[model samples]
Target chain A: MRTLYHLALSPQSRLIRLVLGEKRMEVHLRAEPVWERRDEFLAINPAGEVPVLVEDDGSTIAGSQAIAEYLEECDDTIPLLPGTIADRAEIRRLVSWFDRKFDREVTDLLVGEKVMKRFLGIGEPSSSAIRAGHANLQIHLAYIAWLAERRTWLAGDKFSLADLAAAAHLSCVDYLGDVPWDHAPEAKEWYARVKSRPAFRSLLADAVPGLRPVGHYADLDF
Target chain B: MRTLYHLALSPQSRLIRLVLGEKRMEVHLRAEPVWERRDEFLAINPAGEVPVLVEDDGSTIAGSQAIAEYLEECDDTIPLLPGTIADRAEIRRLVSWFDRKFDREVTDLLVGEKVMKRFLGIGEPSSSAIRAGHANLQIHLAYIAWLAERRTWLAGDKFSLADLAAAAHLSCVDYLGDVPWDHAPEAKEWYARVKSRPAFRSLLADAVPGLRPVGHYADLDF
Candidate 1:
């Protein structure tokens, strides 16, 4: 058995958890409040970011993508990533988009707009930034919808890490009711497939104390 | 021959250019003004970002990382990236550090203070953000120097993608005389080695019209 040190509410942590759950490997989920910065946790990861995995060999893996790749290599039986070179590139691209662009333009924006004010002690939300974030989301969501319509999964027919990355960020946005699911049936369906899996149960149950959940936060149908 | 859509001033685009040069692959370099969008550029990359490589097969690869991976697949002799899984993960983590973390903290601040103000017709710059960016750079360069002292290259012996990622963003920051090169001699030596390459030649010549070049902009040994 391995151990995963991560924040309960983080999409990346949950994504990694889902992958491990799918593989039926036991991973002790240890909560690490990265923002609070425990000294031991900082030593494990100088970046102080979560989704850090301690493997059986005592080697530590930080960064969700790195951890996911390490796991895929540890056991290739249930490949969460693609095999061929081109397939791998495509999967990496999609994973990066959700991790970078979607995370920046969508997830980052939503979190900053709807969440960061209370967290940062920055007086009241910046309405201009929030509006800009929403506008950016509109564009990103459209592009995602277009991508979803063309493929069964995000990168291709097989379920890959790309889907997990997307679901992770989208899940957070969804929790805030910030995602425009009605406008993107394709994206919605894609998420539904990811959501229905038993592995997603832990992710869906997560809650942050002061930040109240949206009306449909726990509703499976929503 | 592949065609690379690049902005000469952009380090990400320059890194791809460097790789292409190292591989001796003939790539038609199209110097695009990314800020002012064009239809053709949009057709190639939905994100409207630079370093889009249009492969000979007419398939386009967007994202510097994705484009770099696609190019690596085409040719491996030069080996711009690591081969082993663990090493590659390390390389990718470092690459992400500069591309994401540095971008958000250092580059964004400097660019906002130096570049964005000019772009938006905002006079002068925010003195506070520039000071903050400088303070942040002091810390980042120290880390780079620390890492350089321990390894032959950023990730390890091989000059992997991590080098290009660091140089790309740093080069942009350097253009504004933001890099405290004298503060980190090891990092300075690394930069000199990287900048001296034929691939970096084009990058060194970039000039943002209204902004005067940093006094030592193209001084190779400096």
Candidate 2:
């Protein structure tokens, strides 16, 4: 069996898990405390980050995008990046948007401050960052709504890594009850569709000890 | 001809330029002041970052990795991401190392502070950040030396995108005379080899107005 070193709340980790689930690949999950910077984990991934995938054959692939691309190449049965070269580029663009931009503006502010800090003992969450996160979330949600209104999926007519990357980040924020779904109805509708996917089941079920998810986090009707 | 909207000092933009140069692709370069947040630029890439590529057909691709991957897919003549899927994964891992981790730890602190802040008029640079960048650069340089000493190139036997991405970031810092090349002779040797390549010529010639590069920045034999 393949193994994945991940954190419960890590949007990158959740993105991979969703991708694996979508591809129907089975993987044993091991929560990695990246802050501790364990020697073995560092040996596998010198960056000390999550979403490192180790094949049963002992080959290791670190970094979420690397793992996602490797998986897409190795298994084309359920192509997450399905399209022409240009279309695939669009999907990747959105993937980078969510993974990098959205993460920096929203997830890092909310999840990083509110949750990860508590676990890592990095000091109390900053009210200013939380306020900024809320402000930024509205912008991102509006963008999502814009995309959702304009296309069948986030990238185009088909589901791709873009949707997964976005939903992954949004899901993490949703877990913390940071998302104001009512403000962006179109984005909420699109997310509800993504949330109802079978691949998203495990994520909604995720419980980071001592931090209970919001009441509607696991609700399909949400 | 394809056009690349970029900032001369941006590591991401430089990486793409190097890749394009390596592939023998000609592109009309347009320096975009991203801080100005031009509305037309935002229409193409809502994220509003540079290194956005527009094909002759008017189709566009944003983000460095997206453009790099798209170019790789469209043209296989001189493959930057060469070898097996696992091999490519390793290359991407290193690309992420420099593009994300190293950028955060070193390039962003050095070039971002010493140069970008001056251009953007974002107040004075922090001495503490410059100090931290120098400290982190040693660790990254040592890591580069470790990898260079073992492999023929940063990723493996072949010159790959990993080398380009790392060199792109280092070159920007090198332009500002922030890289402590003396501390890591092995990494310096590797960088010297990359610097001598014809693909690196344009980057060496890049001159940002109002600020001159270090004297050794354009020196192939440095």
Candidate 3:
């Protein structure tokens, strides 16, 4: 059986899960404390990154983008990536843009300062970092809104990996009530569609021990 | 005729030049000051990054990996990337490993502190950043050395995109006298092979107007 070694609430992990769910692929989710670097998980992913997928054929895949591509290659039906070479490249670029750039600018600050501290058994969240993350997220969401406003999906009419990538980042923030949904109604509406998906249900149900979800986290209409 | 939109001093551009030259492909080098963001270049690559290839057929390719893949697709002779899907994935992963991570930890620091300072007309280097960068460089170079000590090439036997990515970052730092070639013997030897290539001659000739080459940069035998 295929198995995924993942951390709950990790955007990349969630993105992979969403893609797998969309594909209707059956894979056992083995929650891995990526930050803890357990020896077994480290053996699987030397980078100690989350969302390492182990294929039934026994080929281990690391990197969320790589895993997604590998899954697409393994199964042809219900493609999550955009169609056409150009379109694929566009979507990949957007996915990368969010995964790397936006994560650094927005999600990271929030997660590291707020979520990580709480997980590490540290005290209260840093107000300044929270404020900074909140501000940055608004800008990021506005950009997403602009992109969402123009295309039926992030790349085009087809729901591609870009949607999963964007949702992965957004959902993490939304769980903490960090997303200013009012800033981008279209983006929020898109998030609603994304969160309602069967794949996302698993993510919504995830509880990080002491990290309680914001009241709006489980609300489909919120 | 094939044309390369490149920053002359950029080793990534140099790597592309070498690949083009090795294939005996005649390419007109069109120096693109990426920082300037000219309208023409922006139309070619919205990201405004270097090594955008404008093929004779008027098709434009962006991203180093994308350009390389296109090149491999266009011409199968003198193959750069390794064969097999797994090998291709491994090569791409390594290419990204260096291109993104190492660039941030190593290249960006040296370039920003040294290269960008001169280009942007900023005076004096940030000693603290340089000290921090040097420490980071040692760690990165050690990993490269370890990898080089084991594999025939960065990714495998074939000179893949990983080599180009590594060379791109190293060459920039080498120009700035940041690379301690004397310390990392394995990486240094690998650099010798990369540098000795006839295709690398053009790269060695690159000279930024206000910045002169560090003492040993052009000494191929060094």
Best by TM-score: 2
* DockQ metric for all predictions: 0.47, 0.91, 0.31
Candidate 2 clash pair list: none
Better of 2 and 3 by TM-score: 2
lDDT of 2 by residue, B1-222 (tens): 999999999999999999999999999999999999889999998898988999999999999999999999999799999999999999999998998899999998999998899878899999999999999999999999999999999999999999999999999999998888999999999999999999999999999998899999999877
State the local distance difference test value for candidate 2.
0.95
Docking tier of model 2: it is high
Range of the 10 consecutive residues with the lowest summed lDDT in candidate 2 chain B: B112-121
Best-matching candidate per DockQ:
2
| Pick by TM-score: 1 or 3, better one | 1
Assess every candidate by TM-score: 0.90, 0.99, 0.85
Local distance difference test, each candidate: 0.79, 0.95, 0.78
**Candidate 3 C-alpha lDDT tens digits along B93-197:** 676667667777777678877777676566887888888889989987887888899999888777877787788778888887888887899999998988887
Question: Candidate 3 — which residues are off by over 4 angstroms?
Answer: A56-58, A117-130, B1-81, B117-126
Q: Where is the poorest 10-residue window by lDDT in model 3 chain B?
A: B64-73
lDDT of 3 by residue, A7-90 (tens): 777888888998999898988999886657679877776667777888778778787866786787667689876476656666
Give lDDT tens digits, candidate 1, residues B20-106: 877778889888777677888988786778878887888777877777777787788888766677777777678777877788778
